[model samples]
Target: MNAPITIDTPRTRISALATDHTALLLDYRLRNRDHLAPSEPARGAEYYTEQAVASRIAQVEAEAEAGSALHLAALDRASGQLVALCSFTNIVRGPFQACHLGFSVDHAHEGSGLMAEVAGAGINYVFDQLRLHRIMAAHMPRNERSAGLLARLGFEREGYARSYLRINGQWEDMVLLSLVDDRPGA
Candidate 1:
């Protein structure tokens, strides 16, 4: 299995979390609870606890060891505060060679192109490091920000799904998009 990766962008340092960063995960979750509550499922207050975040960190790290998934966090280069997160989950190798992408940005960094900067790096890592042939992402129909970002990233519109996911206790329609890596030997 490959080790967790770290990349330095112009304004942020992006890397996967380790088991020791439980407090950092807790703080990031608590700070973004309100900002992320809409699209994510409710995990109650317990989910924001340090123990829970530690367990989750362990879980994702194990998945990384298994080559099944990864979660990359981007920290501000100056302050070291987490500014964004990108997850590439459900990695299927064999003949599929694909995975699902999810992301969120700090509300303070919204509209500042931070997500694009971080997510672009994540996508490149997925393709180059993971050697995945394709990456899939979906966003709610009302989320024009996500739609525009995916478009700018060159993800093609795959198809619209009706009630594709149960988000925030409600079934929501999703606009699915995908990007394929067509480089030599991909």
Candidate 2:
């Protein structure tokens, strides 16, 4: 409920998306659609349409406004351009103060450790500032890079979900990874 977490990097920062950032958001989403497609099979060229993107943006903002979840936009600190996105979604408050974490980086920025850096910052905010106990990441088994990043970030492989979600048009399995706040008695 505190201000949404802002992640700062040497060259960029990740902050909540403002409605006025439509242009940047659309560009980021469209530009990264290819890089993100493999991981997010549900996305397609049609999915990147402005109407669809705007609807999703509205949904995210509504969720944030309702105290349900937070969506942070990764911006190049120098140019002030959106390059990526990371979000905590489907948040449940109360005893289950937890949510699903998901992200995508512009292909131009991949292999630069930017995703991991952003994730570390976002996870810290969820655990420390938001006081959440757990953040879950689900990825397809074929996404070796994503799995590796989760492991490197200290998230444990929790389990596997069969047909966890629909990717593109087919049901796919997901490897569930979790990061827990193990701070003494936390």
Candidate 3:
């Protein structure tokens, strides 16, 4: 397996999720459940349990080892609190070197640009280290904050899909966006 990646920003440290971080992840998810409900699907009771989080961490670690996914957490430098989560999921190699990105920031850290900071680092790793060609992100039409963040990350609007995903128990329309690695020979 590749060495764990860590990116230190001005205010936070973004590191690849590991089994040891399961408790922190569970705490962050539980604390932000209400804040994230509008944008995320409802989680089952077990989702908040330590056992489930540990299993998830193990699965994510396995996927990272297999080159299929990268899951990272942004933690506050001083407080050691999880501030955001970023994931490059469903990674496809060979000719289709791309992945779908999913992310969310803690409510307490919203509008602080921490998500952008961490996501930028994650994207760099995806492009430079992983040598992926494209990264795609989708957001509900009403999610202005996500749209703005994606724009700042240089993603272009690709299209829109009706009922692109189920969120909060209902089908949500999504605006699809993608960022292509334009570096030479990428």
User: Which runs in model 2 stand beyond 4 Å of their true positions?
Assistant: 2-5, 44-46
The C-alpha stretches of model 3 lying farther than 4 A from their native spots are: none
Candidate 3 lDDT over residue span 1-186, tens digit each: 279788899998888999879889999989998999999987888888999999999999999899899999988999999999999999998899999999999999899898899899999989999899999999999999999999999999999999989999999999999999998888
Q: How close is candidate 1 to the true structure, as a TM-score?
A: 0.96
Residue 36 in model 3: shift from native, Å?
0.9
* Each prediction's TM-score versus the true structure: 0.96, 0.91, 0.96
Clashing pairs in 3: none
Model 2 residue 20 distance off true place after TM-score fit, in angstroms = 2.1
Model 1 per-residue lDDT tens digits across residues 63-156: 8888899888888999988888899999999999999999999988988989999999999988988899999999999999899889988899
- What's the true lDDT of residue 164 in model 3? 85
> Number of clashing residue pairs in every model?
0, 1, 0
lDDT per model vs. reference: 0.89, 0.82, 0.93
Clashes of 1: 0
- Residue pairs with colliding backbones in model 2 are 41-168
Model 3, position 71: C-alpha lDDT score: 95
